[model samples]
Target: MQSQDVAPRPTPASDPVVDVEQAEAALVEHYPRLVRIAYLVLPPGLGRGRRVMTAHALAQRALPRGRAASPVIPAQANGRDGDPGYAFVRLRVLRAALEAGGKRRGLPKRSQLPPLLPQVWGLKLFPRSGGADELALDQQLSALSGPARAAYVLRGLEKLPDGDVRRILTEAGAADADAALRAADRVPARYELLSSPEFDACSLQARPTDLMRRRQHTKAALAAAVAIAVCGALVALPGDGWGPDGAAAPVYAQNPAAEAALDPGRLVRVTGTAWESAARTDFSAWPARGDLVDDDGLLRRALAVWARPGEKVRLSFTPGTQTGGPAGPPQLLYAGTVDNARVVILYDGLRIARYAEPKDGTAGAALDFARVDGASGAEAAAIVLDRADGNVRYLTAPWVKKAAERDLMKPGAGAMDLTVTDGITSPLASPATRAGACTSWNVLQLTDDTGTHVLSDLGELVPARLTTGRPAKEKDATGSQALHAWAPYACSLGAVRSQGVRSVNAWQFAEQELPDGSGTGDWACTRAETWRGDGSRTLAQFHTPGGAYGAVVAKAEGGPACGPRDPHVLAGVLWKSEGGHWYLLAAGSRDTASIRATGGISGSAQGHVLAVRAKEGAQAELEGTLEDGRSISGLR
Candidate 1:
């Protein structure tokens, strides 16, 4: 063991050019949420949990293999671009912590990272109040290292010219101070050439072969024809070949076999793709025909069943049945509907479920008619759409034995209803009107003032001081699954999607408050969260106990930071106005004075306010103004 040391291998002159494709794929894959990203970039000084490693893992998983080694160095490299090694280093640290028993080993999950606030102008979440100094912002940014801060700010906020920014980021080293400062000033370079795949492909000299070009032309012609025919039946069939220059093409009817199989007056049920749907029309005026075509063009055999919302449609198959089955050739019949408003079936009138090709197309939740204890003519059908292959198959429910009839009625009154309000411009409505009942769910809708209408069925609203808001959990059922109690203002929220059982919907409304406890300005909030347990129990168990309660409280200018380890209450007079500002005043005694609020008047004009009194644990009336100058009167 005397002395035989080996020399280190020389490192490559340059890291392999960051893999652009790999990096892009990674970014697309994880697609980190805004809050999740914030939890990483923002210092632990804020009330963030130890999930930075999880975030990094998600980001890493986004990239393809070998691509992760060479992430497309962000094209915009100006400012303190993130150190290429930083993310990897963090990942290593997190993995190490996890391996070492994490907290039990006394290891910090995430380093007290400095604030990598974006350098972009006008992204300040806090108002430009005299009390809130740049030093304070710097202190907030303190968790981030110098370069990390610069990178976070430029990329996250200013959204500087990324290409040049990328160059600056790649070139700047941890050792250079002046270069680092200058890097901050450099505008992100515009590399339009590499910005998009189309542009990149066009800039290259690769030319298509003659045969390839001809094939492309053939594809284009075929695509055009298909589009014409698929959209409106004007497209010529490919098998028909080319037609004389301007000669009109002839329509291709179904094969004689398929045609022979189809009959209009016979009440025949046709189950097939849009191509097969050519036999039906949309919004069919005749009750018989209308029942067949849905707005989406999905063929419905029991159209008469759903055509009249609450009507039961009875259908009989032709005398000589072809498809063999215990119940003979399946005769399409409209069964009794469940939900009242829109016509989507409800399982046992409660558990909440539906079958749609585009939504739950996997047939994972398709109903089984054959399995039904008491059956009818094809009690149900299962349509499977493989997201991977875009293929669809329809299978009849297994339980149908005999046909039965039941009265269809609308859902109960307390059940919610949805209407397109002001936010969305389109007037289209989902075919299913009833909001299926689900124990937990989130409703993400736009508010009148361009804010969000984030609601949850939290048994009932709880109490919390202002500073930040809690996320809402929404149920995931088919159709207009849930209804809104009242018709507030009209706002169009595109199709609603579920976040998850635990994924909560957060909200931030704008308002102002008086120095005393009385309410003053306009403020409204639909943010809610409910526990899965008993309704009688207080909702406190669902969130961190001894923390701020319902109705977040914050400082008028600075904030109402998280309290010390000791449990205590903090209150503030919160207010909002149509002028695009929110204010909170100390109407009563409250200890905390400063707060960092998210989801307020942002990227758009809106007003808000939150002020905490000198004492901690106090109450005050909540008030604010609406865009129409209406007063936001009361809150318990």
Candidate 2:
């Protein structure tokens, strides 16, 4: 039922009419509280930065445009009780905030976009991170509908009674105020948390953008502006008039090389069978396969944007990937319509540039770049075609004969066949989009002439290859033993999202027999290698016998502890046995000759593994000696 079906509560026959000045007074007096309410009521999907800005914008715009009649419903007991001015401004803010979050049939309202006046160009502002309790509350609120969130905020934050909340929600355009109130009741009564810094948009932490990258962009913009001015002067001198290129930056210079790079005809297109006869198989050999490959206008716009993206374009680059124009004409990998956007993939020798625009027009275009300089074999097997609604579609290599989806957490469940049309696989659930506890991870498994290989989406243009075995001798994670070995640590992949991860390898390091005669437990280390050759993450996971999942005992970022360079890992966990006995179980790689523990608990062992009886909740430090006499500390 629509909110209009519910009539607002009746007020006194004579109520004070509120003018713009009175509403402004109430807004200024309760600015912080009102902004907090708006922040809590705004949609969480807009991200913290955007939500903070939108909340302030809505609160600031709460005052009436001109003198107006006060609503029949009176204000609640929120300090400004019975004040018609406060009630009027509060209703205005609530309506606009709800409208901003609600879906509409046409173009978005001004409230949904970034505010024109209050903007921080070189810095990002957001609320400070809170503890787990705040995070849980935020997640719960995020799951609620926009109207439900507003109801909860009104009831908890404004301390409004049920009748007042109903009236406010109805006036704020909730489709069903009763349903929204019912939905809000499901949330735990954590009213005190409503005033915490976690939801306060007035108090925010600011972080500057990448200074070096910003400087580079500034230099490029200045150079482009100068070139555009010269080109304008030349055009004014009178020759042929140049027309506008849709959604692309103006031509920066009139040089042969630069002009060729932007020419649609100059884009390199590999034949369908090129990979079959090529000496080396990589993205360079993949044939362009998309419906828009011959669309000159689209190709020209894509090429032009890659050369010099306009200010309006949403540009993103993988870590360490240079966001600069190509040196020469780039190879065209694919150009087609994916969902609502037309996508074009171009690859230079060092990087891959993906340009996408709306199918209807080029108004909201985006360009993304990723480094793929030395990718080959399975590493170059798939490129992300599109990501929408927590799902991702992939453009597989031409050599791939079959595509399937496998749940890494359930290695024995087998794989589900996926339809492949023109080298594009059907959309699969992406692990990168998952939040909270990870119960399952879906990975793409592609079968080629050689063997099957698994790849995972890490929120990048390219999916990361998965491998198993010893560090240097890692093989494809397709074998039964390898799959089982990786099953326990599959959820650990969440730690490497958006890190420009190139590949991930899982290696079983050591196993320890339980002291209480329980089954043996396994120890494994998972490492994520990035395309930039650094910032790898290593996790030492412990999988107890019969446990459904592994526990990460230790983790380190940008270290060689669990990598090929230093292929030894030592970690300990306080595990409770079925008999209710506590033990400190420590295990090192096979190469470790001795292990010792100190600090809170003391223990020593001759072999690579050790199990010591210890008290619960005890802390300790571990050190190990390898057979080569090199000393090493435990993974932290």
Candidate 3:
């Protein structure tokens, strides 16, 4: 068809505009191309099925509301002879696609939702699979930001030059068009792959969703609806029917065990002096002590919510921890008012569940869960009482006679006394909440009859215990030498926040003297062990003689290196001396008989230390021989 075949009638010079009729004509002629643009620019997290539907919806909705002036920009010279109607419709599609992938200032846009008109009922439609090259390009595009992806699509699919792409992006509300172009340049230019079936939303592959799963879901949904109706009727009858569960969800089914769990009277409260004679000292020995311990109403509400939390409750869980309701009546650890909220702590032998509600009402409640199945010793010595204003309060063990705050970065500084009232320590600055440069790390030091132990909060309900020494003979981090060992690597603890860490042990494995006689560098390995008996992280750190903090040379997650199972660890770092020369510095544990470096650089040394002259940015592989004649590879 000719260009003028669908053009609207000529208008006056003072009121030149593209009306709805002209825009619709351009959209109908170039529907496939416009849909491809939207598909490529839409966020990939929505999956291929939704991307196809949204792409079609955006292209169909690209018509102008009425008569609108086209943006004052030169159109690309590819085709259509710079048609104003095509440009107007293209800009609308591009703007809507970008908005769908990002946040807007005012109300949520319609493009963000599943397209209402262009959705399929039982069939899921997605673009056809392409070759490896197309798949790689799709992955690379997915990694780019929305604006960057739009820039790439406009350049490749639309065959527009960089200048046109930049102008179109700016006119479409992109904040930084140059930045988008720069980011697009990082992707390899495989422009031909843009026409592959993998990106063509017009020609799609259709498949029916799992029929069996849908059937099961429909049956479950109907059952739930009936149960909800029954519960609503019972609630309307009043009397003793599920009275005020706070923010908890409505009960769908009636069961004797669940009812018993919701009863506040069934909560196990320990005696104050139980730990003195108990065979095992752990959270089981924690005594019930809170001003609201006698407040039956608050306790009942807390227990009810713990059994069945509602949608309004804010819930958080540590890694690998489950959020299911309690199996039976749980133990009461603490129930009282803290700061602006009424908090309650409960332990069900496997997990520690914390429930908190507002003081004025039950709205805006929060619940948190952390796995503490086999906790004892220092690991079970303290429970977080309250966390507010970047500070934390802990209810220490009954045996803890004194509480103090110490900075792990400043080991030489004396510990500051903190007031302990009813086994609760005053608020201390939490290192997990600190931002920017981590110059200092504060830890809680609790002194009991055994000695002193240190605990650091890792953004969880329970604090992770700190220790230092060899893997076989690890001890509490209270000695001067142990404190010094933990100073340089303390800030590195931020890497393990919210990871359910139970304890962290720092071991100084080796020390090497610099080749240029600059100074001695200490090699230390820190291992963080989680409560789930897995996901242990080990770091090999290098600390120079006069450096403020140690640098992590090598690290491994869930590896046997630096642990008791495999006490031997070897690591290397490329260091530059004050004399302006580069060298490969490597060290192994004390039991190592010799160490060697290969691949890109070669060196061999006796007695667990090796320093070889090398170039900067050179990669090398290390091997070590233990005293028992076993070989070990360097930590990656």
Candidate 4:
């Protein structure tokens, strides 16, 4: 699995220079995929420094003779483009190794690979999962280290056609290129052909010049001095502004305003809704760091590292009810102890100057806990807690930047943990009880015999219900049992009384139905109501012997019959202004982030068809924006 143990690769019949040229030819074809693989393999960290260096050197050497004269960064190797060349390089390296009689060790046998690479689970077919895709592809190159990751990425994700990956790695390591290529046989067989010069060259050579033209055009256009609105829907919005030299501009926008600007090119972002989107898009894996702790015992050691010779240190801790009375914020104990320790009282954890703990033994401090609102300029905040024996528990001074309060807040909710300490007796660790501290945004997790649901961090269910819950049909209508949805959508039951059904058919929650009834997966139905788009008039009835009549309508064109042939179901649409027309507006999915824009015109479908209308002059505008600035409209 280590880099050193890779299988050896077969040498080309020609000299090393000729072989390098052949490899370059193959590499040029599939370099994009290979670069992606490399990034996946050489994950950021000190661990990858050597490997990154190794891969870069190899890539430099693999450049074809003429191309080397003016070495330009491969378009595929750019960070924004996902460095697919690394993936292709991985494929090529593995292939070269296989042909060179490299050890077939570590690679899952063909049988094992099929199961390991199950299309349903392993492929991550979701269109938005480029990060996940990178993870999945790199998972295969587990045995190899940083360089191997680069190599595999080039061949696999980038689908590079040649053993240039092996050449690159070998060249970087200053080892025999043929032997190094052979060593890559440690990878699986599926990736072997990916590196073969013949295979890679064929693919590269066969690629149409038109594609090259398009790629070059895109690069040039994106790099151009001006921003051209290619199309309203496809226009590339510069992040901050156009870069000085035509590189992709970094766009910066915030909140509801920036919600609509998410586009194909603005992949990694740092501010506003773009921040959340970027976090979701770029971070395929979870954080590996540990939780933040403010224990005084730990703080003492932390202080040794954080304290400056002349600089003052402040320790903060929250007092619990068991501390007998208000010690103020639990931070008083740490302050008192630091006072006793004779450290300079330059500031308190609240960043307050010269504050004193209450003298009446009121158990807690009277100082406000909000003093350190934004005092993160310091390296660490020293903290101390009281022990049962009256001895200072310990101290902990965590790095301020990484220890920001935001780190403590849980996702989809918030939490505040304050430890009560009475500089006098052992501070009760459990005094930190949940009381008025609970906020509306706070999450209350409730699990019972039936199912589990989370109450919003905010104590009010009305807000959670209003935001996450469905609108009630009526007083007599069944109230929606709260359904938990990690995704944007969930399947819930809906019903209209027979009388109500006469006017608007309210379909009950049925089991999931696949696009094609033939058999696949079912969709989660959140809203199923019968309404016409004419903005007026409700239907009186449906079953009138003539295939049912009313404001309700069926697909303008009936879809395929019940069978396995159809891969997906038809997307539902809304009737537009035109007659007998239903335009495809959106693709439905449980996850809002996964929903694709089907557009008003695509395939055979058009606009929405109404079943019935609520009344005359009834119109609604829904609030949701597509990746483009275009707003998705329907309900107001």
Q: Which candidate would rank higher by TM-score, 3 or 4?
A: 3
What stretches of model 3 exceed 4 Å from their correct place? 1-255
Q: Give the clash count for model 1.
A: 110
What's the best-to-worst order under lDDT? 3, 2, 4, 1
Tens digit of lDDT per residue, candidate 3, span 1-636?
A: 011111122122212376675576568656777898899999999988899999999998988566543211111111233567677778888889998999766877798988997978888777644434566789999999889999987777666778778878877778899999999999997765665556768756455566788999998999999899988898788676656658876677577887888888999999999999988778989998888988889988888777677655655666678777788888888988888788889999999998888799997677778899999878888988876555789988888989999999899997999999998899999875553346788999998878899999887889999999889789999978889889988977876776789999999998888888877899999999998889999988888877767777777889788998988899888877778788888899999999888887888999899988888656688899999999999887
Give the per-residue lDDT of model 2 (tens digit) for 497-532.
Answer: 666789999999998898888788898999999899
Two-way TM-score contest, 1 vs 3, winner: 3
Give the number of the best model, judged by TM-score.
2
Model 4: which ten-residue window has the lowest total lDDT? 457-466
- For candidate 1, write residues 530-599 as lDDT tens digits: 1221111101101011211122222111111111221112223333323434443322112222232222
> Clashes in each model (backbone N, CA, C under 3 Å)?
110, 0, 1, 122
Where in model 4 is the C-alpha error above 4 Å?
A: 1-297, 303-516, 519-636
Local distance difference test values of all predictions, in order: 0.25, 0.80, 0.80, 0.25
State residue 590's C-alpha deviation in candidate 1, in Å.
Answer: 16
TM-score of each: 0.23, 0.66, 0.65, 0.23
| Per-model RMSD to reference | 26.3, 15.8, 19.1, 24.5
Candidate 2, which segments miss by more than 4 Å at Cα? 1-255
